[model samples]
Target chain A: MQQLNEQANIALKRTVIVAIFAAVAVVLSLVESLIPLNMGVPGAKLGLANIMVLTCLYFLRARDALMMVLLKTLLTAFIFGTFSSFLFSIMGALFSFVAMWFLLWVGRDKLSFIGISIVGGIAHNIGQLTAACIYFNTSKIFYYLPMLLIMGVLTGIAVGIAVRYLVPSLSKLSLFENFLG
Target chain B: MKRGDILLIGLVVVIALAFIIPRWFDRDSSEKNHNELRTAKITVDGKLFKEVELTQEEQTVEVENEHGLNILKIHDYGIEMIDADCPDKVCLSFGFVDRTGGTIICLPHKLMVEIQGPAEEDGIDATVK
Candidate 1:
């Protein structure tokens, strides 16, 4: 009976942490959009929300991270963007999540947060651009690939650095330490 | 740096080079014939919608698609997306394209406005190249 209660408590703690991270992800996405960090490329934003996503990935399970991604994308699109924007964000978020998860699993010892984030960023751009190309029915849109790739690297590095700093602090908290473990 | 970091750097460098090389060659060839007449081709859903001489009088071309509306303003030597109903307004933000191989695209509307030089013997448009 005691073991069952302890297990339930752990599950509840995990659920609360996931909810908190999802809310933080949504707020970060909203704030990033407001900044208008246009690098001369269409649909290019700073991707500040990625920092929160990476933190969730590092401190939580893959399913939890994915849940955060889905929640953030849907909420941000409904509140601040249109249907088309929703499509792009969903594609980008899913791609980034998959790439980051794969890299973290396979290269946990060989790669740092920065490297994984960079790959995630590049994958996000590829996913968004692919959707754009399909919608436009033209391959000429690939002309923008180079610009987007460059910006992805820059922003990915920024997000990675943020995660590196934040993860350590969050891990220090007893609630997160227990839940994450 | 770890082995993975080195590999990632190499991958980025190779991708960058791939994109830059073609653009470099294109610039060299286009610069040689700077006086070639330019034409603006507007395509919607991969079909040619209209062709306008860039050197002709200013005009506004309105395009309506299942997705949204886009208004293109053409000048004597350049073209710009003056207005668009797309949420991102990426086409409008592309500003003016006066060069021989410039383009403005509205992904939501599947609209493409590309500036091309005179038809080459190869029959390939500058943008496709």
Candidate 2:
């Protein structure tokens, strides 16, 4: 009976943390929209929400991180995007999540978190452009690839530095020690 | 930055430079040798829609079809997307394309406006669009 109660408590704690992170991801995306980056390339943003997603991935289980990404993408699209925008965000989120997860799994401690974030950022761009090319049925969309790749590398460095600072601070609090993966 | 992070960034920068430097040279060479008039080729869904010469006089080209509506303004030997009905409006953000080999693309509407030199012999498919 004690084991069962403890298991239930852990599950509830996990659920609450995931929900809070998802909300944070949504808010970060809203904040991102207010900043205009006129890079002369279409569909380029700072990927601010990625900070929260990366934090979730590091501290929580893979399933929890995936859940946060899905919730974030859905809420952002519903609030501030169209059907096509929704399609693009969903594709980017999935690609970033998969890349991050696979790198974390394969590299273990050999790879820095910053490197993983960079790959995720680039993967996100690739996924969005893939969606655009398929939708338009034209390969011309690749013209923007170089610009987007450079943007990804720069922004990935920013997000990765942020997460590096954030994880330690959150872990220091010890509020959810049992929940940390 | 960690060793791995530096390595990763180096690889990405190299790849980006590989793609960008050649295009920069292409644009520079195209601009120097071509003294004739330049034209803006607009394509929709990979098909040529209209080819307009870039002149001193400003002109507006309205592209409306099943996909969406895009308003292009041409003036001062350059072309810009003045307005668009597409949801993202990314094409408008491209500002202006004044040089040969420059391009403005609207993905939602499947529209592309590319500046080309007079001596360019390639047809639509040669553009790789």
**What local lDDT score does residue A175 receive in model 2, on the 0 to 100 scale?**
57
Model 2: what is its DockQ?
A: 0.51
For all candidates in order, the CA lDDT equals 0.80, 0.84
Instruction: Give, for candidate 1 chain A, the lowest lDDT window spanning 10 residues.
Output: A36-45
lDDT, candidate 2, at A164: 89
Per residue, candidate 1 scores C-alpha lDDT tens digits across B1-129 of 467866786788679778877887776666555455678899987789999877546888898878789998887578999999986677877887776667898766778898876766556556652
Which residue pairs collide in model 2, if any? none
Q: Please, what are the lDDT tens digits per residue for candidate 2 over residues A62-144?
A: 99999989999999989877777789889989999999999888875767778888889989999988987787565666777
**Model 1 ranges off by over 4 Å:** A179-181, B1-3, B34-38, B44-49, B56-58, B64-69, B76-78, B98-102, B108-110, B115-117, B120-129
Work out the TM-score per prediction: 0.85, 0.86
User: Per-residue lDDT of A1-181 in model 1, one digit per residue for the tens?
Assistant: 9999988987888788778887888888777756765577766677888888888888778998898889888888877777776897799889999999999989989988888888888889888878877876656667777877777777877887888898888988887866454
Off-target runs (Cα >4 Å) in candidate 2 are B33-51, B54-57, B64-69, B85-88, B98-102, B107-129
Lowest lDDT 10-residue stretch of candidate 2 chain A? A132-141
lDDT of 2 by residue, B1-129 (tens): 678788889999999989999987876765564457799999998788999998768999999999989999998778999999986678988887887667788866878888877766665545342
